[model samples]
Target: MTLFVALAVLAAVVSFVCSIVVWKLGLRFKLYPQIRERDVHTRPTPRLGGIAIFIGILAAFGAAWLVSSLGPDRFSLLTIVFENPAQVLSILGAALMIVLLGVADDLWDLDWMTKLAGQFIAAGLVAWQGVSIVSLPIGGISVGSSWMSAVVTVFAIVLVMNAVNFIDGLDGLVAGVTLIANGVFFIYTYLLVQQTSPFNYFNLASLIAVVLVGALAGFLPINWHPAKMFMGDAGALLVGLLMATSAIAVTGQINPAAAGIEDLFAAFIPIILPFAVLVIPLLDFGLAVLRRLRAGKSPFSADRKHLHHRLLDMGHSHLHAVLIFYAWTAVVAVGCLLTYVLPVYLGTSARWALLFIGVGFVVCAVITLAPLGRRKRLTVAAEEAPAAELPGVDELAGVPETHGPVTAEAAPVESPEPPNGAR
Candidate 1:
């Protein structure tokens, strides 16, 4: 745990510094493209933050490799790396490929077919390097033939990548949401490792989660509302790829029968946690795809009808919409994590975890729907008001009603047009 903390800190510092450098270089070189009609932000912003994030992750992995080579035998994290150099290298290589593909798309606006081809190649590379899912935790069922395992793993990775990228419409939405989700996932993985390999208490999944948490923490200051830069497609896709990898590394490798986890629900946590953490992104992605297909358009076609867009249309402020995402992510991710934790540590029934989830859902529903209720009330009040008492259009538009001629300074400035998409 101490070593892991040190590595996370190292990654955070490196990513922070790199982000600053990238931001400056972007401005100096005029690397950002013009703002599109569908973009939420007013100004053109750089989208190369993913390159810095990837560098930070790479640095952490490199440091881990060095420590594994030089450190003493007792450091189990070192040993894990030493034992699986091929797998580690493959993950990094795949990440590099993804970053390059994303950077090109960010700069050139590549077609969907081109992007999909790259995604499949990267996913296939990782699966071929033995990151493929071998079995399910459910009743110790295996995933069947090697070919089947590879196909399933590749498909899963691609699905997660797109799902995550679909929600990149808002500033800091992906970074903050990933931070919260991965934080909970890190805890779950660490606890699972302690139960399964008590002596070591270290694994690939937890390492990936912690490193991601650090990278996002470092990048988020710049990616926040009124962002200096966006993570763009590159960062979003990279995050999704790593997240899917981490889930597979932990979930696929664990043998429920050997781990002595008898409870059926407990055994399923490995499968459930990833979905629980990614519920929002997955939901948005699914809806978008279905909507586009119904309209006879490409599933990957861009639009302003995303869930976040709906929140903006419902009258939620920019900051409020982002916070709502964070809140729901925390509620769902932590709720699922507790289901695994309470049973193992407190000998309590899983029903307690269910109760927590139920209460959390109710709270989140209220927060999410509150804007719509407020809007409805405002509309009703406006409709019922007497015509004479109601302010005229000029007054409502910030022009003061006066008998005297208004000065230029006192005249209402035309409000800037709202961006087509939600922030």
Candidate 2:
């Protein structure tokens, strides 16, 4: 407990300092995001926020190691770092690869396929650490691995990476969601550690999860709407890679005995847990792909058709739209937890929850499709007059146009004399 608390405080401090450094460097270098046709923001903002987040995470891990080694206890939570050196190396290496790839994309626009290929390569490296899902649980039944499981694991990684990236569209959306997700993962994995036959990998996962949350919490204030900085592809992909890898580290590996169930059930629990925790990204990925396919378009194409865009279309301001999405994410997260721990009661809770969800959807739908208002602006003179004495459109009908440059289409049609000849 002391170690974890120290880790959190250390991480927060490192993140806060790194954020300041990154902000200063970004301003100096003029590395800012320009408004693109597809972008929602109308202003230029700094784009190197990822550099701060990455540095913060690395520094936090270092601090954790130092504290574990020096705190009178020769062996500490940081032993997980040395115990699973291969896995640690794999995670760091893959994160570096993805972050660099993303930074490249931000600095010099990379093609979609290029970034996609990079993500796959990084996931493959992480998987090479013997991290792969071998089974799953469905309705209390165990499902074991075949060729299908391998394909599914790889596909899940790819989808999760994109989902995290997709949610990065709004300020604070990805950061806030990432923080929440990691916080939950930290608690879940910590509880798993307390059970008999604890997995050391889970301990390492909690450390990383807390580190991620601390970094995001430190940076979110600057990234929030009316934002001073944009995370850009650099930060988004780093987050995606970190989250997918963390999920893989926890749920993708298994110890049959630790699962505490006979047959395949034990092996399935850990496998299912990661997916359950990442329900939002997984669901968003599925919805995005389905929507694209239904539109007869490539699923990889970018547009203003994301869920966040729909919320904005519904007349919610940017911040409100983001908050609404955040609320939905929290709801899904809570639902997944309920289902996992109390599978029987989840049905009843879900039924009640669905009503509120339906109401939310309807409200957003109505706001998006509603028409503009009917009122018109008038001059101060018109406003000063009594409401009943105000001049009607008919009273000012056929008023002569004010002088201005003629439009190209009307340049040749100017009359030789005014029709009223008042001039």
Q: Pick the candidate with the highest TM-score.
A: 1
In every candidate, how many clashes are there?
Answer: 0, 1
**Whole-model lDDT per candidate:** 0.83, 0.64
lDDT (Cα, tens digit) per residue for candidate 1, span 267-350:
777778888888999999999999999999999988888888887777677778888989889888888887777777988777
Show where candidate 2 strays beyond 4 Å.
67-73, 137-151, 198-202, 252-280, 291-297, 339-423
TM-score of each: 0.93, 0.73
Off by over 4 Å in 1: 72-77, 252-262, 391-410, 416-423
Give the range where candidate 1 is weakest over 10 consecutive residues by summed lDDT: 414-423
Error of 2 at 301 (Å): 2.3
Q: Per-residue CA lDDT of candidate 2, range 186-211, in tens?
A: 76566555653344432666777778
